[model samples]
Target chain A: MDKKKNISMAVIKRLPKYQRYLREMLNNDIDRISSKELSEKIGFTASQIRQDLNCFGDFGQQGYGYNVADLYKEICNILGLTKQYKTIIIGAGNIGQAIANYTNFQKMNFDLVGIFDTNPKLCGLKINDIEIRDIDLLGEFLKENNVDIAIICVPSRSAQGICDMVVKGGIKGIWNFAPIDLSIPKEVIVENVHLSESLLTLSCLMNGAI
Target chain B: MDKKKNISMAVIKRLPKYQRYLREMLNNDIDRISSKELSEKIGFTASQIRQDLNCFGDFGQQGYGYNVADLYKEICNILGLTKQYKTIIIGAGNIGQAIANYTNFQKMNFDLVGIFDTNPKLCGLKINDIEIRDIDLLGEFLKENNVDIAIICVPSRSAQGICDMVVKGGIKGIWNFAPIDLSIPKEVIVENVHLSESLLTLSCLMNGAI
Candidate 1:
């Protein structure tokens, strides 16, 4: 874990995909896999896979390959999946409500402790039995609960304001769904799911690739 | 457009972000901007901005910079936003319904023509005036409608099957929200919005960066 100090973001971004493929293999009773075989399955080249795994620590043997279960656990550890994170969604709009109903996140150790929205009508409504709280109560709720991640499902205009409030209340991670790229302090981690940008990327590629 | 032949996927992905910032400038009544100034706003280095824009065509002048409106229009053209795309949602689940109700995509020229789900009860329900049809009707629907993009919001197990149907129906672009990476033909473009992988990336970074 100490060897992970300065790993490039490109390598880090690929870790989850690696972990995902390993989980599938593990489910299928695969005990071990060579980098070349994993490469074919995961789409990364053999040498690339080896280099990415090496960023964390020495893994695999001369010809024996990586132990599937061991690698899966190791990657999960690196990804902090062993620990539970209390998360709250701000702005219980369509996307926010959808995420709240996405109980898979809860199974993955990201517990949705609260949901907040500015709309008064939505404040008492429940999604997955979790009551949507008023946005005004977000700061107070944050003070009482040890929340780890703030899922910003608000619109672009209100995203930064909610982000500032959450950061001030001691949130460290943000899973932002808003179109706007948030301004945050260095210590805070923000992962954006810019739907429009992603869709545009698809269109751009499809247009040119054709 | 001839210069776009060999542009890297990395540059193509950044085009949306560049367009987004340029649009903000346009809305603010900014007629023009220098590369350096644009870089400061967009978070890309000035040289990087110049190089990315150069992949399409000559953009900013040496001393005069660029016309924001012209750059925005050029990016839109390159991104294929100038053309209208008929899109359909496969799987009327939470994410699917959210996307169907998302009028923003409609405003962007990606019109949602139809939605299909396997659940019998969900069929005939309307979202944004578009009725959800049975999954069995997807192939037929595609044949009748000139759908350019298929948004697959189905589960992992069903995504590939749905993807095969859409591709066979002449869908050139796919906005896949399913966690599993779909196996698609080279002629088709599939952009993924893997939510689980994204959340893991955030948690992984939060762990390491701290």
Candidate 2:
């Protein structure tokens, strides 16, 4: 963990987008790509691409460009996606089921190992071979299964409580889909996916003079 | 439209967070608030808050602080949430359904008017009193109804096609939840919500020294 090498979390968030573009380029047999080319394809500026990639290390030649395969591997290692992560999604509702059924997460090194919900009617139900377990078993199951990440798909009111339980159950990373923000310990990391904010952004763009 | 304002979309995205806090203060009957106090509560610096708000107008006093109600109403107006916007969601899947069922959108002056899905099996389905109609009806629906915002919640493979159709159907604003980024015309506004990017950010926060 090189503190000096700490990239902006904002930049890190776009690694997957870069990865997706690189994958497509690779599939299309594109061996090398310039910052300008990548930027044009990805809707970012050429300088932004260079600045973000330079944070890790020099992966590009002076006049030439970045080797598609090499840059892909470097980004993968930097994003901690070189290996699969054991993940569990809590709340077997619509959003939770979507996570369970999502195929892209499989490509991105997240393995949905289990799902938990307090709804008795939903317990024992299976979505694509993954059974929905009772929330009562979350603590023991997380410990036993050594789950590293837990995605909270519960309602806003239940988010903080579930986050506390997940952290206490030894899961430090959480991807929250709830509208409310959670206050976790310094050791725990919570990322909020506020759908409303995204909608509001679209609304502004619609209403703006642009 | 205040072209001089030129606030970054990122800063605009955080206005809702500030509004949320201001609403809390109003609920608690806190009549006045300084930039420092608001910053401390929201994890932003006082200068950042001042700058973000200053893009709209100066509501702060020299010695005292901002009037809570006045600032709140000003921020709301700046966000264009003073007028209600009719939003229709396409693809009645888990994420779409979740957006329909979400209560905060209505609270934020967005009305979830309609839901569309191409799946014949899901036609005429209802979520939270809103009916899910056939995708073929989107054009007439948009013309008939007052829907100004269209949310694309379909699969990644189908997202681009739906976006094209929606744009042709007279939708100027799109909130795309699919993983892939669509190339929309300059006349149309498209905001993407990538779940994988959010997950990767959480992973980095958990693993990196930051």
Candidate 3:
């Protein structure tokens, strides 16, 4: 893709917030929304909202504003939510098993295809109908199955090795729960899910820093 | 705090990123970091970093930069993390239990005081030295002991009720793991940990939207 067509990360980051608001509107049966109304609800300025939406295409009109469903669908398409991504969890620990049980992922079109664990006892265990497989089979499994994302639930020390293995197996994206940064190729995207960061943000706010 | 002293949310949001990089530098035995070096490591501009740090207090000098350990400690102090926050997990399900097992919180000084679940069977189960208690005692527990933060880890359907109960119990901050936006009182601060948003972010980037 050309540089002009490559959406800015700032705008890309706002997409999820817009999507969340749109999802709420869709649920409430609010079929349409003006940039002003969206700004009121989401705290972004109308002009900023308009500019961000305009980056994608002409979704808004002069008087009718944006059709909530259509805008939501467009956002889903842009975010790849319309496509089903086959995913695997690298660890069968609490964090891994918890993610396996998260239904929101399925709603977002992330299909959990498999779960892998190093422990032999956990291998045969079932979590939300998916049985955990031995970590030994992860390489062969990735080689055979169409796995798009690798959810790293392992601890910090083991996370890099898992990332290397997953990337080597041709996985394109990583959803890392590990607290460490993973060094991967530019072609392979990694999203680090650090829960403590959010807590720290809240902590700072509560500490009168905000 | 007055308007001039009230840090913007944008700056507040960047605190965790700065803290993460600061922690990394300290770990590497890097004693000091210039704004230029920090900007390179954390992707923020040098001036932006300087402004953010200046919002709190003077940390940088003319030639010598910020002392890594002191700055890290300052960040911890600003984040209210230097003080131990008595925390409770509201659900003993997969997410809650997993969070109870998370070692990162203790390192950040958020002590997990108790674990509570509505299900009677889960009560008394131990997760990392903290035994799960009946959800019924959450009110009395909060009344008797000090709880600075309440982690809402129940399902979306039950998250609101739990939030209301926790807020009514006189907690200050919430670390919500549920997939719902909670309607909370103005006094209560919430940091919604929506894992799916992060997933969608990665999805968009992978879809070449970024």
Compute each candidate's TM-score over C-alphas. 0.98, 0.92, 0.89
The lDDT of each candidate is: 0.91, 0.83, 0.88
> Which of 1 and 2 is ahead in TM-score?
1
Better of 1 and 2 by DockQ: 1
Better of 2 and 3 by DockQ: 3
- DockQ value for model 2: 0.53
Off by over 4 Å in 3: A1-6, B1-6, B36-48
Compute the lDDT of residue A146 as modeled in candidate 2: 82
Candidate closest to the true structure, highest DockQ: 1
Assess candidate 2 and give its lDDT: 0.83
Q: Write the per-residue lDDT of candidate 1 for residues B28-142, one digit (tens) a residue.
A: 9999899899888989999999888888677788889998888899899989999999999998888998898789999999988989999999998899999999999988988
True contacts kept of 1: 0.70
**lDDT (C-alpha) at residue B48 in model 3:** 92
Per candidate, the number of residue pairs that clash is 0, 0, 0
- All candidates: DockQ: 0.70, 0.53, 0.63
How do the residues A96-141 of candidate 2 rate in per-residue lDDT, one tens digit apiece? 8887887778777788899999999999999879899999999899
